[model samples]
Target chain A: MAKVPSELRYSKEHEWVKLEGATAVMGITDYAQAELGDVVYLNLPPKGTALVQSHKMGEIESVKAVSDLFAPVSGVVAEVNQAAIDSPELVNKDPFGGGWLVKATGIEPGELANLLTAAAYESFLEGLATSGH
Target chain B: MFLTPLNPLHRAAGARMVRFAGWEMPLQYTGILDEHRSVRRGAGIFDVSHMGRLEITGPQALDLLQSLCPTDVAALEDGQGQYTVLCHLTGGILDDCVVYRQGEGRFLLVCNASNRPKLISWIAGWQRRFPGACLIDRTEALGMLAVQGPAAPGLVAEALGTGLLALPRFHLGQGLFQGDPVLAARTGYTGEDGFEVMPAAAQAPALWRALTERGAAPCGLGARDTLRLEAALLLYGNDIDESRDPFSAGLGRLVNLDKGAFLGREPLARTKARGPAERLVGLRMVGREVARHAYPILESGHRVGAVTSGSYAPWLECNIALGYVEARLAEAGTVLQVDVRGRLAEAVVVPRPFYRRSAASGEAAPREPRAASAGA
Candidate 1:
């Protein structure tokens, strides 16, 4: 089973977001990393880039496939994780911690409502597991 | 889906299964990187039973095969195998194959599984002209395993109790495993010293078990693909197809047009004289991002070609690709650009075979330790 900590909010795109006041730190969930296999490369938006909620912000490349990473909430990119960029395996090792991809500040209030709670994301993942995706 | 004899074993080994060319095969066991490293450093075994094997035997077997395949089949003595291609009348490649001469009047053709039906029909259509020859599909009754890496020969000898390293490159030897006949050929796609063994279907499971128990890492198609790509070996469906000819794909050496009249010979000769408009070339991405299949190749902001195959070559520790570009721009070191999912990235033309063994020794030479990392 994938971990869905009660503290962080989740997106249908599989990103986990932890809001710190107006700043939101985000990374792909553990379930996302497990599905991706070995993460080889990551292309993240640069700092100060404006992102729209649910829009594609970047891409994550695995050995077998490449996937688009979506923005969970609209805001200006505040910081990009250089450690995750340099060594992509970190995302596979500690996706919930050091693997955090980016931080976004000046978040909109309505965007948080669009995100899923821990319980809701857990059920969503359960649906995906049973569906044989 | 069709299953190889080792399907049960793959599942037991915790393989991630996928549908490939109408067969249920393992995409990876443990991981592609780990399996790839095992083959490059130690040894790995691949269940390639899905490949099609056809047997041709008769007084006219060699003559019939020579007329269809582009390789110089008449030059092959008994026990020798040569990589060649089957072509259509328009000089389009039908499929690439390895033809093995078993004896004076017998031959074997190993082909891609997905093209088996087409190849059989194409060959059968010419049966009337060579009534002395007999073609038999041995795929259903036979199983193939590729034991690869530097340690492959020793591991295989210990498992089957027969020395195979003595077999020269492209040579086949007959041996017995548990008293059953098996054929070992010093051939592989991984660009490493290895042997491909063929045994009866019923005996495959046992043979696989013994090989793995003796330290042959069980690998899957995922690693097999990366290894072949790193070696610059062409995948039929991806790198060569009916839309392209062997000459344009950088395999002109295999097309023996001077030998005589053959299928696709006239067009191939004409194209050889005129030179190809597009030529296949190897590309090493300057960026970390991979340029996958069908991605546009650009030269000076203009679309010139498209990628046929691309990946993060685990062994090279770099993103590499194979693609056909305007022949004038196919020279090695030619800087190009590729649109990787709308992200334009720099790519440079490099010589084929992105990786090579340190020593230019024969196929059976002892293995050397690989670099600790790509940086080395």
Candidate 2:
């Protein structure tokens, strides 16, 4: 079973959003990193780019495969995680905390309705696990 | 789905399984990078039983093979093996293989898994000419394992016996495993000092377990690709295919054109005369973006060629690739660019074989420990 923290919100595409008032910190969920497997590169959007809710934000690549990263909420990119960008393996080792992808401000709180709670995401992941993917 | 004898073992070990060449096989256990480094720095074991193993025997066996292959099959003495290519009538490579002369008038041809069915039916058609020859498919009956790295020989000896290491490069020896005969060959795809042991299908799991128990990390096709790519060894479907001939693929040494009439002799001779238009070259990326298969190789803004195999070479600690560029731009140090997902990444032409072992298995020299040799 993958870790789905109770406090954080999750997206169906496997992104996690932790809203702090007007600012929101986001990263890939633990389930996302395990499925990605030993991330080697990231193609994150630069700061100042406006990210739309549940949209393609960037790409995460492993040695063998590539997957698109999705944004959980619509906001303007305030900060890019340089530490995670410098060391991609950190995403594999710590997907939630240090591996956070970006910080965004100018949050649209209405978008939070589409996000799932910890219990909902856990059940969603279980649904994926049993679908034989 | 086709599965190796060790399929259950791989599942038990929590390996990530993937489908390749019609067989379900492990893609990784721990991770690709971790297993790649394990094989380069220490020892790693690979279950390569999925590759086709054919047994050709009879009085006319050598003659039949000699007529089919561009390689000098008659040159191989008993117990020796040589890496060579099987060519089509157009001089395109049918598949790359290693032919081992097990004994008088007997040979074992190991080939890529994807091309096995094609080769079997194709070779059977030629068997009509050599009424004295026989071909037997031994892929299911036998299982092959490659134990590779600098520490491989020592560990193999410790687990099996010291006599196994006495065999020279490209030579075969029989090792005793629980009173049964296990065929061991001093040949490998990983460009390291190692042995490829062929055991009966029933005994494969035991052999793999014994090696892993003795400290050989179980690796998968993921790492196997990286290791072989680092050495610039051709992957049949990726690097050399029926659409491409051996000479253009940088396998001219395997083609003994003057030896005699063979399958692709005439076309190969003409190709030798005119020279290849596109030559395969090694590319080292200046950045981390990997140049994946079919990505266009760019000289300027125009497309010059395409990358065949590209990856972050775990051993070299840099991104490396093999691709066919225009012959004019194949020279070393020529700057080229690979369009990595629409981003042009800078790359330069370097020599083939981006990695080489200090004492590779190709050398005929005995590599027993200095301590053991000093006493003797």
The best candidate by TM-score is 2
lDDT digits (tens) for residues B14-117 of candidate 2: 99888999999999999899998998888999999999999899999988899879999999877888998888899999999999888888999999999999
Chain B vs. true chain B: TM-score for each candidate? 0.95, 0.96
Q: In model 2, where do residues sit more than 4 Å from their true spots?
A: B360-376
Task: Name the best candidate (by DockQ).
Answer: 2
The CAPRI category of model 1 is: medium
How well is each residue in B1-376 modelled by candidate 1, as lDDT tens digits? 7899989989887788888889989888877888999999989999999999999889988878988988889998778899999999999999998898888888899999999999999999887799988899999898999999888877777765444556678877765689766887888999988888898988999999998998999998989999999999999889899999988999999988778878999999999999999999999999897988889999999999999999899888999999999999999999999998777999999999998865544463544331111100
Residue-wise C-alpha lDDT for candidate 2, range A1-133, written one tens digit per residue: 6889999999999999998878999999999888777788888999999999988998888887778888899999999999988899999888888999999999988888889999999999999989865
Give each model a TM-score: 0.94, 0.95
**Model 2's DockQ score:** 0.76
lDDT (CA) per prediction: 0.88, 0.88
